[model samples]
Target: MMREILSFCALTALLLTGCTMAPPYSRPEAPIPQDWPSGPAYKDAFSKPDAALAVEVQWRKFFNDHRLQTVIAMALKNNRDLRVAALNVEKARALYRVQRAELFPTLETGISAKKERVKISGTQGMVNLEEYSINLGISSWEIDFFGRIRSLKKRALEEYLASEQGRRSAEILLISEVANAYLTLAADRENLKLARSTLETQQAAYNLIRRRFEVGFAPELDLRQVQTRVDTARVDVARYTELTAQDENALHLLAGSPIPADLLPRELSLVKPLPDVSPGTSSEVLLRRPDILQAEHVLKAANANIGAARAAFFPRISLTSAIGTASGDLSGLFETGSFVWSYAPRIVLPIFDARTRPALEATQVARKIALAQYERSIQIAFRETADALASRGTLGDRMAAQQSLVDATARTYQLSNARYEKGIDIYLNVLDAQRSLYAAQQGLIAIRLAKLVNQVRLYEVLGGGGDASTSPEGL
Candidate 1:
């Protein structure tokens, strides 16, 4: 009988293994257009057929600078937030394994001894009784005829995938953040250097005017005007110095370790430019972004949950069985002809459960919510990529125009100072020219920094990172 029961259970499980009560799942249509938006903002955008996809480009190749690559590596290894994300992925994986294991019966083995007192029916006296047995069998294992357990397993698998994608997103964001902080520090340092240089020039002019006043060749007013320029430059130098220090602190936090002095950026001009990336002609690239993929996985998990909820309305079948050897004496427990077995199959059909309908409705609503969230993620990615492309369109022109202004102002300053020496103009003219040149130089530095930071933003939004191979689903 025990052998027959085991054969029946195996056959039943095999027959129901492929059955599922859940609705068929299909990916919803993307709510956005196939091609990227085009307007004045995206005028300069272009794509190359031979260029690698933004998602496939390695961070090391994109960054170019050896020092920055080193810092990013450090952050990936030690950043606390990223570490927590990785841990979460592991936790989700374990949970999925636990759920999947439910599809199979758990086999258990044990030895037992029993002692009890039983009252005699006729003698009105109590007698001791003892028995021993050894058993190996399954207990209360659900038979998934309705696919309820399988649906729950599927949901767990999708959730695990979603968690993995989330970890990748966190890693990409951290890399971009580190690069931005490093660039900021370099820009501030350059600004500080420019201010100090301007202050020295103004101080020298002030000294010259003071000497002329003492000799009765220049007035006190001319000396005071040059002194004002010196003081203004002094103020800027102090401000930029403070900013550079703060930038370093921010970089340190991202790196999660002290940066080597030699590895730190000294000036924006010295930092190498990031490699160019194509947005491709299609906006579908956004689907490959880690965050978007994570959202889609969440949607899949929700869909699977709906199937589990549907399965709940059907009959639930469970099997409990044991086969072993038993005897009144412990020494004879495993002897031949002492074999014993039991099989108890149970079924639970929901007759009047008030929560079943509401539970199914809740799962359907949850799936709709996940669908909306997935579409929203795609929209947000499109906007971010569009904004970055827009900045790219005009930054080159801005840089060129800024450089021209700096050159023009420098010429004006030199000419004004020469005219004042020859008594062709008032000393006030030279003071004004000096101020214009200093301001123009500052503007050029700012434009350069913007151009570089924009490149980083574009790469980040396009999901540029080198860690994982592209998913076969193309997301």
Candidate 2:
């Protein structure tokens, strides 16, 4: 009879699993475009199926600066924010392990020994007895045929992958920041050099005027004007020197070490040009960017949760069974005659749920929200890619023009100094030319750094987070 009852209960659990609304999850269909939106043609010739798409490029390698690479390496190793991101990957992995463990049965074992002395009422005498028992149990949660637990485990794994991708994204950003900061410091050093050189040149002219005044070939007014030019140049040089120091300090912080100036890059010389972004192929960033990968995992988790929510509407099945012996005397425990066993299957059906419908609605809405976030993430990636590509084109043109201006200003400054020395122009004219040259020089430095920074931004915008195969630290 007991066997028949247990068999019927198993059959009943299977029928309940079938009756529940456990829908199979599917990704919504999206319109896959054949080409990029802008005028980016693929190679202008037959290409071997996106040879560049084979692997995500290492941004550090692209910079090709050993100093920059070292700084980024240190930052990746020791930066606090990046460490926090790495820790999150471990948390996600633990969550995944917990979910995975749910797919298997659980076992519990128990043992107890007690001693009691009591007075017997109504029949007259005091009695003392010792009792002992031991139990072993094996139980399981019914997955039935609904695959609810399976979906949950799948969601957890996706989330774990997502966390790992997030860590990669952090790494990319940290490396980019270190490279950019190093570049910026190098530019500042150049500006300082230019300022000092200009100051010394003006001082030489001032000395020439002072000598002429002492020999009566120049007036006191001429000497004063030349002295003013020299003093002003010295002031500007000092200002830039201070700024250069600040930039160096910032570079040190970014690199996670205080590198000596001699050890650091001190002049802008490398030709790491900004990337020529093409925005190549629609939604490619979605597959490439790490943050996007993480977002999609979140969406997958939400979808899996929908099945989990729907499963709540049906009966829940859990089994518990035990084999044990109980005896009035401690010596009788586990004896030949002491044997007992019990098994139970629990089924809880929601017969009159007062608030369950709303709960299901909430999960449904949550799924929609996750889907919306995922879609929005894709749209944002596209927009960022477009913006980076457009800026790359625009900045390239602007920097070319700015470079010309820098060259022109230097030529003008040189001519103005020569004319002043030959008495064809005033000292004020030479000073004004120097100022123009300085401004143009600084502006060019800014633009150059912008171009370099944008190259890194383009890579980040492309969503190139690595896959699950990349191991998380302390995992």
Candidate 3:
């Protein structure tokens, strides 16, 4: 009969505490326009209709280069920031479990014995008093009649989910960083190679001009001009050498380990092109972004906190119960007639505590703050995707113009050099053509790198070329 009564009470507690005081949650409308902004800058901003969304593509497939894929994998495994984010997810999960466990009673068991000396009423000597008992019980466990504990459990669960989204956001950011670093290093190496090739060409020209001057076939000014070009090329070669070394160091840092020589890119020209990505016509995709989702989860957690705070206003109920057996003699501790049971119920009414009202107000304010943050996250995401689209629209024209300029300059340099060799033109014309050609070539490389990197930026700002649902290695 006692066991039946205890089970009934436990079931009633569970049923009563199931409901929450939290307001219904409806996702806020996206603050951005329905469609991606269209203008001259967004002319070619989108991919084919059939192309997959950036978030649907996996990192391994988006980054097709074998070497780049290997580097990103290594970084994902070793990056400290990503590892910390994963650890935080684990920590939040543990905290949620702790909070959830409070919804049920905690049972404990114990055995105790006591002996003391006492004086008898009419005796001169003292007598020994002995007590022995064994028991099983619960201690001050909350029954949660007003749903305060349940609301807190909900808050903890939302926080755990938020932490998980944060980890996904970290993983996406790290992959893009590693890829960008790799691309930057490749571009710098290409620049170094160009400088070295130019140096070799100028050095050979200087030797030829020197021989001509010795034979009185070329003027002293011609020899000096050729020598100046050679010196300038030498300077560029040294500068780019330094730049390439620094680029490698940055790549190594992003990779979180020393990059193998075989995995390093020799030049941008040799690297494969990155695949194109599509941002669907709707701005709704931003809602699925990990950072945005993380913000929403945080807002939901804040909402849950408000529920907990509101539940504090009415009353708080807790149950402390014990069902056990006890006896004065050790042998009788578990005897038939020694069984006992007790239940103490407590209710705390917040009649005039100064803290309750303030706490509730604080939670309301926090929810507002979280709402603002959630809206701001959407705004920022929209801006990033817009900026990447703007660059994408104009980069193709820029690349074409730069390539044409390089071709024109190369032709001018070839014609001027031939004329100088035939004694029909002065050395200054060749000098000017040589400088123009070098500048145009360097500009072409810059434009090429910009175009490629813009593609990467587009991939990143559209929430990355990876799925958030799947966990990465180490996470």
Candidate 4:
């Protein structure tokens, strides 16, 4: 009979698993254009659309710099923010396990002993009594007939998935930040070198002018003019030196440790540009981005919560059962005649509750909010990718133009110096030409850095070359 009772309970539980109050879930339509933007700005950028997913590209393959690869690898292992994100995933997994366990009964076993003394008012004596029992039982375990427990479990599972995606988002952001910081450091180093070289050349010119003035051959105005140029170059050298130091500090912070000197880029020329990537034709690709995936998982969790809230309005059933032995004496506790058992079933019907209706309404509203958030994530991703593509298209042309300007200015500065020495032009002409050459050279460096940084931004906004199924370790 006990075996039959257990089998019946198992069957009932199995049937209950099929009954869920949660509404069916369907992904909302993406609120962006079906195709990527096309115009003069995107003409060159959209030339090639690859079918390959971005997330599959390894960081090592994306960044050719060996030192940069080493820094990113170290950051992945030691960065505190990434570590916290990974821990959150583990925590969410544990919470989901706790919720999932509620679907099944929890069995407990124990032994108990008791002693009591009783006295009768009329009687001259008191009596002592003792009782003992042993039993195995399930406490008030909810039967989940309305799927409340199941819905809660579903919510927990979605939260866990969301946390996993959150971790991936952190990793992608970290990768981009590290790459940008490294590039900035390299650019600053190059600028400092240029500034120091310019200062040395200007100082040489200033020294010659001062000697010519002292010997009464050059005017005082020419001496002062050359001196001013030297001072300006010196200021630039100092400013760039400070910028390079700060860039190193920023890179170390992102790396989560002090960076080795050898790992730092020696000059801008040595830091290779990342290879070009094809941003796919459709904005649907943004749906696979980690942040977007995280938002969708959160929305699903909210949807599951609505099911749990709705289930609260229905009747709840719980069961408690025990099988044990009892007797007046401890020795007879397990005797055949001492065998005992019990079953208690409870039903909680909510005929009226001020909180239940409000709670359900709140969950519905929350689901709506989550849906908005999911859509917003999609919109933001679209804008970012579009902006990156636009910048990428124009940056190449701009860099090329700046390079040509540098070449023209350098030639002008050379001719002006020769003309001034031959007395064909005044000192002011040499000064103006030198200034233009310096400005043009600096502008070229700035444009080169922008072109490199834009590539990193494009890769980041396109979702870092991998999908949700890819492991975080792959970053």
TM-score of every prediction relative to native: 0.95, 0.83, 0.95, 0.95
- Model 2 C-alpha lDDT per residue in residues 258-311, reported as the tens digit of each score: 775555777775544432333444455455577766777787777777777777
Q: What is the lDDT of residue 258 in candidate 1?
A: 86
Residues 368-475, candidate 4, lDDT per residue (tens digit)?
999999999999999999999999888878988999999999999999999999988899999999999989988988888888888888888888744445333321
Off by over 4 Å in 4: 50-52, 119-124, 465-467, 470-475
Q: Considering summed lDDT, which 10 consecutive residues are worst modelled in model 2? A: 40-49
Clashing pairs in 3: none
Which residue runs of candidate 1 sit more than 4 Å off their true CA positions? Answer: 1-16, 47-50, 469-475
What TM-score, to 2 decimals, does candidate 1 have? 0.95
Q: Global CA lDDT of candidate 2, please? A: 0.71
Candidates 2 and 3 compared: the better one by lDDT is 3
Please write out the lDDT profile of model 3 over residues 291-363, one tens digit for every residue: 8988998999999898899988887777777877777778888778988888788887778888989999999
Candidate 3 — what's its lDDT? Answer: 0.86
Compare candidates 1 and 2 on TM-score and give the better one.
1
Shift in Å, residue 60, candidate 3: 0.6
Over 1-475, each residue of candidate 1 has an lDDT whose tens digit, in order, gives 6598689867876855676767788888888889887887666655335666788888889999988889889889888999999999889888988998888888988799998999978877898888999988888989888788888988888888899999999999999999999998998999999999989998898888999999999988998898889899999999999999999888888888888888889999999987778888789888889999899989988988988899999999998888899988888986789998877889999998999999999999999999999999999999999888888887877889999999999999999999999998998999899888988988998888888889888889999983673342421
